[model samples]
Target: MTDLNQAIETLSHHEEGVFPRKALETLLDNQEAVNPQLLDYLESVAIDPTGTIESWQTDFLVVALFLLAQFRDVRAYQPLIKLLNKLDSETDWILGEEGLSRILASVCDGDVTPLQALAENPEIAEYIRSEAFYALLTLVCRGQWDKSALHDYCRRMLEGGLNYEGGYLRISLTHICEMMMFSDLLETIRNCYQKWPEMSEFIRFDEVEESLQSGEADEFGLSFHRDYITDAIADLEKHACFVAGDGAEGDDLDGFDLSELFGSPDDVASEVEGFFANAETQETFVRDLPKVGRNDPCPCGSGKKFKKCCGK
Candidate 1:
């Protein structure tokens, strides 16, 4: 067999943690030298009919796709896009889509119509749709497309409320506002805050508020709900149970009968008060117990250092 064929066979069967990425990278960089072999291997991996590619092989396959995108040739575009279309919402496929996004953005060619269709397709899973939206937005930010068109899309996107769904309770529309260098959409988002108070978490209200308070911005900014103290007080009141009269001295409230357990109210009150007062002092003594260094001998009679015996 030729040397390139030998390299492909060697790479596909490489053991775990023994990836041939550097060699593959060299071949990908020199596309003219190894295009035939590299593309053949990519097609074989991408069209695995049995769906039985081993985990390690799957990792290498995605890396191969990523390297093809880095080649920045139109030839890699259609294959990557087709692979994206065939992918499902499975975790593995989601990861593959992420790799596809990099390829899509690099070879965007100033035409985002395909990406926009995917972004607006409600039939597709949000994971993939969000990736498309991000890729589209990335093109606009990179000056690959006209700003006015993307701005209009951003406005329309905000009109229906951001469709972002992921961790951290935030979305990318706020980031788009910064990237587009316009605050009109931001104002619209803030205006919606009165009706939807949760929008504050997604937008960085703290930074804006600080900026406004410092006279860094002209407007007073939107009203943010900083009612943490009020919420905390409400929680305390909910948990507070106020007995009508003295517990031990009067008829036992809540039927607990504290007198039976301890004694009369006077004795119980004195003991409890004294216990609280002395508790702090006793706690200090307990906390002041000599610190046992990790390397010091264990105090449990193990005859070993603290780290070796108890710390472990």
Candidate 2:
């Protein structure tokens, strides 16, 4: 067996030397038999600063935790909450946002008390603060908190300057708008947006009207429009750049156009329409979109598949 396989075998009791996918399937099938093992594995990894654990091991742990939550195993709450808090402190050491998000999705349904506690902590890290904001918005969207409470909480947090970092603050503000929209707290949302014009890109009136007409506000409510607007604004900002001028370092080139390189606007529109017109094309487009794959080269450009490189 390979050395990694041997290592997995030494750590786990399964016959195979590899972290078995069947283990996860089995755990999901029978929560009682696998929860203890899953909990032990999660605790070990939570304290593992060196990150010697394999990617499959982490994946299995996360899956098992999610299953635990799905099964309504209240015992999983404390450990999951503790991990969320520590993940903020050790963002670099952990498996990054994907792992954190998976954990959040698992435990978010049980009890939001942990999130509230984290928000109230004086030593909250920037990562934790951002996550708490996200969690609160999620709770609001899920109808766990009433509209008035959610609005007041978001307002208090923002006014308190808990999310003072530029990027974190911007994201928090965007999420606040999302929560307000979900709860139909439009007056409050508009107040906050008016107070911060920089947040205009994060809110969209057209999509809100569309959602209202379609009666599709049941899930994310009108906030889906705000997210779309923010995404479009972000895309525009990403492509905005200044090119070098004659002798000077550079000149601000606002309203620069690159339609020639991309053909006509009609051509661009057709390509986009074609992408959405066929299932195969849509699937291909989605697959090509930036994503992390276990078999693809590590994003760090380590020249190795994620499972065998940094993710290892």
Candidate 3:
């Protein structure tokens, strides 16, 4: 058995990928039963840190939570739930909410009250709420809930439709319709054109009918178009909200095309080092690398096509 003491000690450097995956895999592979020590370690990592210094710990924690689920033990559920409670659309923890949804999809088992609570909470960020909304939708669509109850749930989802910032909600709605198939909600979505008459200019059904007549129609094509209309209705304006600006040194190369100088990343790094060591060689360092055709034999002489070998 792998030493549990060493595994727990290595988590202080959880920002590195190898330790978490190895530690969790060891815990999962060895014991037939759930270990309280392992569970405690998962809980500590899963908790969102208040300081930015350990911000990347959230990513490590998410990986741990997912590894916990592979064992199918219910003990992992509560720690995963606590991660869901920390979802913030504005936060840098990209996987915290998304990872929770993925883990819950398999383990919730008809108990989606926690998901519903997060979805209904107005205080949560809109993006996180939309994620929770889709997670609940996924459960309802897959679970063996009563037909009437399912219908009610779908109605509530459409009625409480999301505002289309970042276009995430529309994407979620499209997925829900495609997965759930034809239902009462399809009719409800069709009637949305009448209720929001202004959106009619943005959405049209003529092409959908034409495609159906021409045998070119796709499943849920109408739902896909409706999602587009939802985005159009929002009259999206460019916002710097999610746009990541380049670093200070990179900002000076605004109109420059940097792709002309190319080589393998390692070769480029070596050239950069050489240039730093002797500034006079800068001009000669940038040169084109010989290109290899995809179908040609690999230069490595392993007797395989380049595309099928290292080119991949």
Candidate 4:
């Protein structure tokens, strides 16, 4: 039986792309012992991001995150939420917005009060702030939160409860309503378009009507956590980037996409590094759009197609 610290150490410093499968399994097998230690380590890194990230040669941050997420320990909630608040949006490129949101949902253990507050907080980076909603929506879809309660909470959001600047919180809340098919809030939603004409530019008022009337879940909404499973080892090794030896970050198939997660391709860093690097750099407003046509004008007002712009 390897100690948790030993297991973590074994997983670290893999410049040669050597994954210690045995060490990771030790963690997975002893989640009750490992989860809190993982959170503590994450908090330590978060407390001194630059120093720690610069010091880390091992991908312990990524390992800890996936483990904590799958364990679904409520204890993991505050530390991850605190990091979400501290990291801001630039990390969006690092973890992929959906990826981070999945972690948030996984760790919340069905308690969404923190997520609601984060989603409604105007001062938080929109990318990070909006993640709370996506995570909450996932929990709702998973039946962790009552659909009626979610419906009511979304109604409150649309009815000026989200009354934050940047208009993103409101837009995000509306998307939640669409996902939940909360048709009861249609009039309230219509009022939003009238109150803020620019809202239509992000999502057409007509599409909202169509989606709500469909009597089915939006495909995008249905697809949130399909890959965020509970088996931590499988979660790690399923991705070739996380594998080691020749299968790891050698010549080709290389580490995961840095543009989607970290560095710049040749570099195989994880979102944990980027999240610790900066707390504010502005998340593009276009990130709030849902299932927008690639051919549509980029919502950021750049006039480029969505595919060519932020959607890319």
* Highest-scoring model, lDDT: 4
lDDT of 4 at 84: 60
lDDT of each: 0.48, 0.46, 0.46, 0.66
Q: Model 4: which residue pairs collide?
A: 13-58, 94-261
For model 3, name the residue pairs that clash: none
Candidate achieving higher lDDT, 3 or 4: 4
Question: Candidate 1 on 135-230: residue-level lDDT in tens?
Answer: 655565456767688778767776663554331112344444444454656565555454455544434455433432453322211111101111
lDDT per residue as tens, model 4, 35-100: 778888878766755566467532677777777888776677787677666664434232322245
Which residue pairs show collisions in model 2? none
- Model 3, position 64, has a per-residue lDDT of 46
Instruction: Sort by TM-score, best first.
Output: 4, 1, 3, 2
Off by over 4 Å in 4: 1-23, 30-33, 50-58, 90-96, 195-202, 225-229, 233-312
- Alpha carbon deviation, residue 19, candidate 2 (Å): 12
Q: Write the per-residue lDDT of candidate 2 for residues 139-221, one digit (tens) a residue.
A: 55456556577666666655544435232344344445443544444444455445655443323433333433453333432
Flag regions of model 2 displaced more than 4 Å. 1-23, 48-59, 88-96, 99-110, 120-128, 141-143, 161-163, 182-312
- Listed in order, each prediction's TM-score against the native is 0.53, 0.48, 0.51, 0.65
Ranked by TM-score, the better of candidates 1 and 3 is 1
